[model samples]
Target: MREDIEFRTEDGVTLRGWHYAPDGATGPTPLVVMAHGFSAVKEHLLDDFAGFFCDGGLGVLVYDNRNLGASDGTPRGEIDPWQQVRDYRTAITWAQTQPWADPERIGIWGSSYSGAHVLVVAALDRRVKAVVSQVPLVSGLANARRLIRSDLFAATRQLFDADRAARYAGAAPQMMQVAWEKDPAEPAALPTQDTHDFFFGPIQDRAPNWRNEVTLRSVEMFVEYEPGAYIADIAPTPLLMVVACQDHLTVADLSLEYFEKARQPKELVALPCGHFEAYVGEAFAESAPRQLAWFRKYL
Candidate 1:
């Protein structure tokens, strides 16, 4: 079952989405707090993913990140990684107070960009009992370099410089397309064929609230983020890293390296697919059950 839900962050921004209750739950149930990757909204396969957990007797709190979807924040379509991390802590706090969620049995789930976020959140907040980071980004600077060409890197920095000047001069933040054509000569945030197909195809068809734009500063912050550094600290708390073997967006090897660094009580399952595939079709079928088992075991 799904109920419309919203909760306030410590900074006072209200995040809105749905709280799912397991069909046969008799009391407060283990709850998984979930959110999407990058600029994706809650409508983008989150419900489908949440369904897996709810059907398996787990409740879920799924919401959009700030400045996107139904959530409230200024400078719409902006993504500040640190701010998003803070919001995850706030979401966990909100979940603790809800009657449908077992305060002591809370797990956190995230995919793609949010997957990277869960790593950071779990390290910082002991409140998170279990964490499933699916096809997560480990090193932003390294991933960005992989996505962008060496020759174009300098130009990208210049663009960021220009946007910073514009913003400081009282102009709105410059925007960039999150993805471009299947074969794009023009630069886009996710300039890959798979990303284009997934975002503009299945993702766009499902989520109109999903935007194709984000502030230029978001990319800068993303590059500056290094969530993998916290992997060792996440030990003692059970950690699960679901890596897509073919994932180049976040890089499978990077995830594996970090997973190796994480302390005991951790597991890594590598799906034989790309980054986006881990969320749907056969890859999702394989990944979701594995994640549910992790949560059930730990949370």
Candidate 2:
């Protein structure tokens, strides 16, 4: 069974999500809280993963982050890492109130940027009994340096600074394409076709709420946001970090380094494909079962 649901953050921002309960569930079941990465919406193929969890007898709550999709907040395309993390906490609190959700057995799942989020959430929120982070961003500064050319890095920094100044001066926040074609004349947060197609192609027909743009301030926050520092704290709470071996976007080595720093009771799984491929087809087939088993054991 599935139902549409809404919850408010501590700031009173309304966030929307879908709640999926496994059929024939006799009582309250473990709930897995999920959200998308970057500017993605709940409809961005997240239902696919939610279905997998539901099949494994787990209730699922997949929501849109504040300020995006059906959620309510100012600055439509704003992406704040801390704010989003707080929203996850809010989601967990709301889920615990549900009659069919087991508060003590809740788990969190995310991929890409949000994959990093679950790491921090699991560390800080003891209520989170398990976590599944797939191709997560370990260090924001390292990723920013890797994606942004050294020559253009200064210019990008200037844009972020300028946007901040403009917003303070009563001007609208500057906007930029989150992903775009490779062109020296056009600047995008993710300029490669792989990144662009990864977000736009597969789920285009399904995810009408997904946007290609975000506030320039998001780039500023992206560089300074580091979730890997909290990895070690997630020990005792089982963690599963899935890596895409050929992923150029998140870089497999970066996640591996963080995994090495993490404490025991953690497992690392590597897929033979790139980042986006893991979301669908043969790759997802291999990865989703592992996630299901992990949640079953821990949550």
* Deviation in Å, model 2, residue 258 alpha carbon: 0.8
Summed over model 1, clashes come to 0
Q: Please report the candidate that would top lDDT against the real structure.
A: 2
lDDT of 1 by residue, 166-250 (tens): 9899999999888886458766887888888888785677787788889989999998899999989987889989999999888
Which stretches of candidate 2 lie above 4 Å from their native place?
181-185
Pairs that collide, model 2: none
Model 2 per-residue lDDT tens digits across residues 1-299: 88999998899899998999999997899999999998889888889999999989999999999889988898999999999999999999999998989989999999998999999999999999999999999999998888888998998888888888898999999988888845534778767667778666756878777788888888789899999999999988999999999988888989888899999899999999988888999999999999999999998
In candidate 1, stretches whose alpha carbon ends up further than 4 angstroms from where it belongs are 181-183
Worst 10 residues of 2 by lDDT: 181-190
